[model samples]
Target: MADSVAVEDPKFTLQEVLDTFKSCLSENKEVFLEHYVAGWLGLVRFMNSLGSVFSFIAKDAVNKIQILINHLNGENGAHYVTVQSMVKYELDNQLVDLTKRGSFPESGCRTLLRLHRALRWLELFLERLRTSTEESKTSVMCSEAYNESLSQHHAWIIRKAAGTAFWALPGRATFFDVMNVGTPEQVVAMLGDALPLISEVYQVTEDLYVQNNILDLP
Candidate 1:
């Protein structure tokens, strides 16, 4: 199932990857978790192209994706159709451990929240990349993005590990080249085209979580 929608293109381009995410957004404003996870899988390939430094983060993200994949492939898979549907299904059936980990340790609400928070960090980091100068530090930009978004959810050890990884990030020039999007100017233009869609998806999911009172789900 994962292979069918997976971003398996060997010659992966950042624009192509981002576009995969953009496709995840449905006209009805409900995001299918399958597509959303596949989008992250695309980003993971991009990160891997940057180098091995980001492997830790990518590995953790893969685990989260796999967990959601399990739910989508489970007996009640029909209810896991969209983010909103999954939340409503699980909540209505008392399948989620709202306040803490219980029978369902990997609740849809909590899992999606983790991905949602990381999406904000990705959006911030990409925006910084888009506007950055030749001398801009990817490490600093990445750390700042993490600090603002995902840091709160991470423990000190994981945060410290991530910080170490950020410091090893390639410079703006290398980062731009890895995107495989023509020249530097073209890369920025591609990002300009991508950011808004990503931001829209992030904001919509955020509002959904907030309205459901599961934004801070444990």
Candidate 2:
């Protein structure tokens, strides 16, 4: 049986985004792609709201995502289909800058790597959100997940910026409301359960990277 999550009153806009994510994760590959792109666009907006510092990283992320989105929905998806191919395309074109010498420091590979790294964090966070026995503070869960995953790969500046974003996170009530799940309390409980599965996915990826020594594959 499918586990059903119910929310009493959902705030339409952002909640729809999260709802879309849940739907994507649960079913619908094309929708999943769209939601992923939409979710990052929101994230970029959220980061931009912070300050100039985040603008740099967010700009890089947004650019790379736009590239991927174009490839996915464009005429060149066949060549940019896989993460590996995307990396090659970006690097070969000199679109990626491995070191931060100027505005664009993240290559498609590195940018994707950052997202890939964050994916682990998202898995952990969602799992935590899914399985919680009580209402969870999305801020806390987000920070905790980052510490274990994305934050490690980030430099000092990014860690500080990401931490700031975590603190700026909406509370459980708003977070769940945005998620369109039934009731904040119920959603928290669900997150607690979901977190472990997400962690498992993160761990598996982490292990694979460590084994291949491809931590910097981008």
Candidate 3:
């Protein structure tokens, strides 16, 4: 299946985006790489809806997603089935460059690590949005979320660009309405329901990265 969102729906509802991510988590709590990438694609759509200021970040995320999709369609595609399986396959077969950069610049481990870090930022930002008041500043919330999660991985230029994008964020009420999930109450309720799944996926991937000592991959 194509990693891109379906064309049948030109606009994305927040619940639909959350469901994409939620579907990534399997019954055993393992995350499927295909579904996870799809979830990010959904998020990119959400970012696009926000406006052109966030296009740069969405572009970077789309590039990463395409790289993973290439691997998923490569000769060793079966090994790239799920996040857990891909990590094991790469580590066992010596496909990842643990300490230094090598020919495989886009190793599965490193690529997933970047997305995994961003996932935490999304989770935090969403939670903040869910609980925030009508008068809350979205730029502040977004910058705080970025600082606490994805900022460490980014350079000064990227951070500055991201800060600018955050400043372009719509008001809290507008953001909630764009979700297309009905009233503010409904949006919050949906966010509450979706957060645990996102948290579990992040924690599971984080633990896997820590255990294998590839969290700091170059």
- Identify the candidate with maximal TM-score: 3
lDDT of each: 0.85, 0.56, 0.87
Once fitted onto the true fold, the runs of candidate 1 whose alpha carbons sit more than 4 angstroms away are: 3-9
Model 3, runs deviating above 4 Å: 3-9
What's every prediction's RMSD, in angstroms? 1.8, 8.0, 1.7
- Point to the candidate with the largest lDDT: 3
Better of 1 and 2 by lDDT: 1
For model 2, residues 114-134, the per-residue Cα lDDT tens digits are 665777777777766665544
Q: Which residue pairs clash within candidate 3?
A: none
Q: What is the descending TM-score order? A: 3, 1, 2
Better model by TM-score, 1 or 2? 1
Q: In every candidate, how many clashes are there?
A: 0, 29, 0
Model 1 agreement with the true structure over 150-207: per-residue lDDT tens digits: 9999999999999999988988888887788999989888989999999998998998
* C-alpha lDDT of candidate 3 relative to the true structure: 0.87
Model 3: per-residue Cα lDDT over 1-218, one tens digit each: 57443423476787887888888878887889988988887888878888888888888888888889888988888999899999999999899998899977889889989999999998999899889888889899999999998999889999998998898999988888878899989999999999998998899999989999988898
